[model samples]
Target chain A: MKSSVRNQFEGTIKAIVRGEAVSEIDVETAAGIMSSIITTRSMEEMGLKVGDKVTAAVKATAVFVEKA
Target chain B: MKSSVRNQFEGTIKAIVRGEAVSEIDVETAAGIMSSIITTRSMEEMGLKVGDKVTAAVKATAVFVEKA
Candidate 1:
């Protein structure tokens, strides 16, 4: 599928922290560990698990940056 | 302030695409252009604009990854 997101990193799942509503997924990439917060439903839908290979697609808008 | 998010990249603002409520921000990092979608209020509060230096903090749950 076509995406407007510019950063796409191929990575392996390192960990998953499941919450009541949201789930935090850690993807180990060459750059580093990329983290993501998604709904538990989406997590289940994706069937994400540790050691799985996945692509982390980040849209420009979802990134929040603060000055250093 | 401390954060649970793991991925933090120092970058410069490249562009900002504003919407009615959410805004898309493009940050130029060494890895590439990191993009984020945030509320307009947050954008205004940060005073985010092109050329500004900021750190992109991404939580594991906020990142969505698909198997490739």
Candidate 2:
């Protein structure tokens, strides 16, 4: 919500899985479960844990729009 | 919203600019204007035009969550 990223979703942490260098976090937002990978160090520094409410931010450049 | 992208927004086409290979599109969504660059070929194939209603989708992997 505070990031420069315009697209933000408020969600609860559903799961957390640790990898070699990065951690996979699954957030259960109203739309769906949004998954992302971040550095384990950042995850620890942020003190993020399962069930914690978080805001997932996606840069506008990373978003693709389409029509059907 | 119809694609595999979990993060999607329904919005009206705000602006579209064509480039040599990719095109920049701006969609005015409820939150904000989502901007993206896509292949001009795909843009033409989709017949996307300004003022059309479209959906913006973001890959989960491209999303990042943080707390403040």
Candidate 3:
């Protein structure tokens, strides 16, 4: 699908930590391993598995930066 | 603020695009320039300016990955 998210981490699925409601998809990207949380239903529907190629996209509006 | 967001990109502010209600903050990180859209009030309260150090944090749930 097309995405407007500027922060796109293209990588392979490192792991999938499934919870009752949500699941964490750990992707191995050049930036390092990043985690994405999605619903278990979506996870199953998407058929995402370890070693699968994916692009982790974060919307600009959802991005929050703190003073460091 | 103490955040539970795992995704953090530490960088210096490259620019701030101000709008009526929200503003876009662009930070230069190792990954490249990342943009964060935040409310103008938060931007003003944080006193973020160009060259200021900040860490862009994205919540795990806010992250969405697509099959590639």
Candidate 4:
């Protein structure tokens, strides 16, 4: 009864939004939900940006439970 | 010549290995690789097991290609 989001996020890469197949990762967390919008195809072979200190290892069933 | 394995696997969960933090997932495929080993954190939540056909989406960055 307690799970909003928090599988893993070691943070930094601020933003990146390029899509053909899928790529829209924005991990910049510190406390909780600083920001996390992930959907990736490795982001052009890990050429990520903004700060680059990654660790976004999500797997909580691919995390999709939208209602809001 | 191009790549060893494809990026996605829309197949059945062939096996599972539970760990303290990460869970090892093995998905069965048709060709190119009958079984592909993956790591996920969604096993408990998803309650995945053998024969459960599910898509395994892995960010290519997390795939650490080790040398043997």
Predicted structure with the largest DockQ when compared to the true one: 3
For model 4, the local distance difference test gives 0.56
Candidate 4 residue lDDT tens string, A7-64: 6657786777766766666677785434434334445555667787776645454667
lDDT per residue for candidate 3 within A1-68, as digits (tens), equals 56567888688999999999999999887666678999999899999999999988888989887885
Q: Write the per-residue lDDT of candidate 1 for residues A1-68, one digit (tens) a residue.
A: 79866778888999999998988888887667788888889889888999999888766545567776
Ranking by lDDT: 3, 1, 2, 4
Backbone clash pairs for candidate 4 read none
Residue-level lDDT of model 3, residues B1-68, one tens digit each, is 56677788788999999999999999887767778999999999999899999988788888987884
Ranking by TM-score: 3, 2, 1, 4
The models' CA-based lDDT, in order, is 0.80, 0.80, 0.86, 0.56
Error of 4 at B4 (Å): 21
TM-score of the A-chain for all models: 0.86, 0.86, 0.85, 0.29
For every candidate structure, what is the RMSD over all alpha carbons to the true structure, in angstroms?
3.9, 3.8, 2.1, 10.9
RMSD of 3: 2.1
Question: Which digits, one per residue and each the tens of the lDDT, describe model 2 over residues B2-68?
Answer: 4566567788888999987988888887656667778889889898889989988878678888775
Question: Which ranges in model 4 have alpha carbons more than 4 Å from their true place?
Answer: A1-68, B1-6, B32-41, B62-68
How well does candidate 2 match the true structure in TM-score terms? 0.67
